[model samples]
Target: MWDIIKEIITYSLFLWIFLVLSYSNSNQGRILGCNGKSECPQRHRNSTINA
Candidate 1:
């Protein structure tokens, strides 16, 4: 019983870490249409082109 619980927790932690890493890595790309051409100036939401 304890082993099963431990396994579940371990898997959950790994999944959480993977999700967080992927989200952080792709977050900027998603915001910039995911085309991979987003630059610093265009990242601002308040900017004319971005807004």
Candidate 2:
């Protein structure tokens, strides 16, 4: 009984987390233009181009 309850709790937690994450990401803009794989460079005005 304990094992079953634990399993159900685990599954519920996972489902809830997934739903929350999906909802949060809905209509959300790109994250840094990358999914934690590489750094995205932003457009910047170069002040020291010849330096």
Candidate 3:
């Protein structure tokens, strides 16, 4: 009854917060050049092609 509803609301809130935090973290990683190897501009600039 009311307890079930409360539980559902609490779980949903936690899930929403988790998602928001993860999304922001990923965005920060991109801004800080922490993305994958091939997609990082700083890495590309510091490495030589050796061709």
Candidate 4:
């Protein structure tokens, strides 16, 4: 009975750690756009023609 409880706790801790690491890694790509458009400044600049 005690072994089963210990196993459950160990698995829960591992799952929590895995979720935290994955969330932090993916957060780097998060960004915001101005003018209520989905375009980023870099992409918008590339699409415009000076002439």
List candidate 2 stretches off by more than 4 Å.
Answer: 28-51
> What residue runs in model 1 are displaced by over 4 Å at the alpha carbon?
27-29, 32-41, 44-51
Each prediction's RMSD to truth: 5.5, 8.1, 5.3, 5.6
Output the lDDT of residue 2, model 4.
100
Native-to-model Cα distance after best TM-score fit, residue 22 in candidate 3, in Å: 0.3
Candidate order by decreasing lDDT: 3, 1, 4, 2
lDDT, model 1: 0.70
Candidate 1, residue 35: CA error in Å? Answer: 4.9
Best candidate (score: lDDT): 3
Task: Evaluate residue 6 in candidate 3 and report its C-alpha lDDT on the 0 to 100 scale.
Answer: 100
lDDT per residue for candidate 1 within 1-51, as digits (tens), equals: 999999999999999999999888866656756453335534553554531
- Clashing residue pairs in candidate 4 are none
Q: Roughly what TM-score does model 1 have, to 2 decimal places?
A: 0.57
Q: Which pairs of residues clash in candidate 2, taking residues 3 or more apart in a chain or in different chains?
A: none
Quality of model 4 by C-alpha lDDT: 0.65
List model 4 lDDT by residue over 1-51, tens digit each. 999999999999999999999887763224443442335453346555432
Candidate 3 C-alpha lDDT tens digits along 1-51? 999999999999999999999887665447776654645655555656531
Task: Report, for every candidate in turn, its global Cα lDDT versus the true structure.
Answer: 0.70, 0.63, 0.73, 0.65
> Relative to the unseen true structure, what is the C-alpha lDDT of residue 10 in candidate 1, on a scale of 0 to 100?
100
